[model samples]
Target: MTIADSPARYGALSRFFHWAIAALLVWQFGGICSEAILGEDHPLAARLSANHTQVGTILFVLIVCRVVWAILNRGRRPDHGPGLLGYAARLGHFSLYALMLAVPTAALLRAWGNERAFAPFGFPIFAPRSPDQVVQTATAIGSNFHGEMAWIMGVLILGHVAMAILHQVAWRDGTLKRMT
Candidate 1:
């Protein structure tokens, strides 16, 4: 089918970004959980934490591209719904985008403040900077904020999934078909 025929569904680029981000998020969350379960001093814990940082950095870059794609492809409509439902869907999407942006943005700031090196595949986000008192302070504050925001994102995601299931099972709507 031509692109126009599937306007309610995501385009090729959008779908790629969506799945890619989803995979990366899973990796990130898994790493976080692993690190928490294992002690910080454990070698496996260190490895998982490092993987989380690297994957988070990749997610940041992918999210930037996705935002640009979303803006450029803004004309494609979402599947139809009641007016209020449609508006709520849009708002939910915007909140997802915001969290996607905020999480990594905070991580980046934490990296900078803590003089932490983000070497993903030998590429660095910034040149290693000298340790600063402010870095520790900022890192503490930013890390707390990041953790809280992550919980918020988790709740929103659960809500989104529940609504999609409701649409599929209760209403027999095709809302989940677009993303899946």
Candidate 2:
């Protein structure tokens, strides 16, 4: 049975989105971090980097589903508690949604505009740029901001995790149970 969301907790779909995205993000950052620390040619880094585009495309799809599901269930999800924490929760979630869309969009735009063919899962999504000319604008945007915005997103995710901990430990609330 599909667990629909209730006033006190998230549904199966919401929890799936939450954990699935969280897992993919872990993969993305693992690749990024591994490349930075162990060099791009290292076996672990190479394997992860090789699948970056495919994983990213998957994440894009998941985010779209997540956004739609969230909107549909907006009224059914738990309320952000009153006062400062609530405001912080709202802002944090908004930032995550915005970044989730923005970061991958930048990469996808670059892939579409650049000379390289971007065929995630062996399906040609974006054809290569003209052989005679190179596109700099979109490539520049992706090169500049894809990693940068992701780091910011990473910070937000850390804050999110910390808040969950606070809710469970300090506040002694079942805030973390909403998704679990």
Candidate 3:
């Protein structure tokens, strides 16, 4: 397959980004769900959660790249449609992209404002924030909406998968093939 997208289908790069992000999202949510099930203090939960920051950091970087690539190939990609389904597809995708960025952004902001060093994979990205001065805004944003928005993103993703299945099964439109 080609590296750049074409009207008929997504190329190698797009597929890589799509599947990579999807796998990482599964890892991310799997960790959360596992923690909830096994108890946050369980050894299994701890093991999964230990890499959360690192994975999220990687995801943020990749999502940024994905956005840029998508824009570069926007004209060559498949169209959503002209009707309501198309509009919903457009909106759902936009929401997914937005949430993909927003969730990690909230975590990064929180880490930046944290009293401890912001380290992902043992590399310090942000030095410790001043003990005397707390970034209330950043903390509040992270605390208030991070998890909630993540769950909302989950719902959007389910819809996305459902649409893909619908296209592949019911509609037989080969929509799933665009990024396959």
For model 3, residues 1-180, the per-residue Cα lDDT tens digits are 799998888989999999999999999998898898999999988888888988998999999999999999999987898899999999999999999999988888887777878878888798887877668888888878888899999899998999899999999998898888
RMSD of 1: 2.8
Give the alpha carbon lDDT tens digit for every residue of 5-83 in model 1: 1566866677778889988887776666667788677787677677676687788899999998888777774655669
User: How accurate locally, in lDDT, is each candidate?
Assistant: 0.76, 0.90, 0.90
**For every model shown, what is its TM-score relative to the native structure?**
0.82, 0.95, 0.96
> Which lDDT tens digits does candidate 2 get at residues 1-180?
256788889999999999999999999999999999999989999988888888999999999999999999999888888899888899999999999999999998788778999998999998887866667888889889998999999999999999999999999889998879
lDDT rank, highest first?
2, 3, 1
- CA lDDT, candidate 2, residue 93: 95
Determine which window of 10 residues in candidate 1 has minimal summed lDDT: 1-10
Best by lDDT: 2
> Model 2 misses residue 155 by how many Å?
1.0
Please identify model 3 stretches exceeding 4 Å from their true place. none
> Candidate 1, TM-score vs. the true structure?
0.82
Model 2 / residue 96 / CA error / Å = 0.5
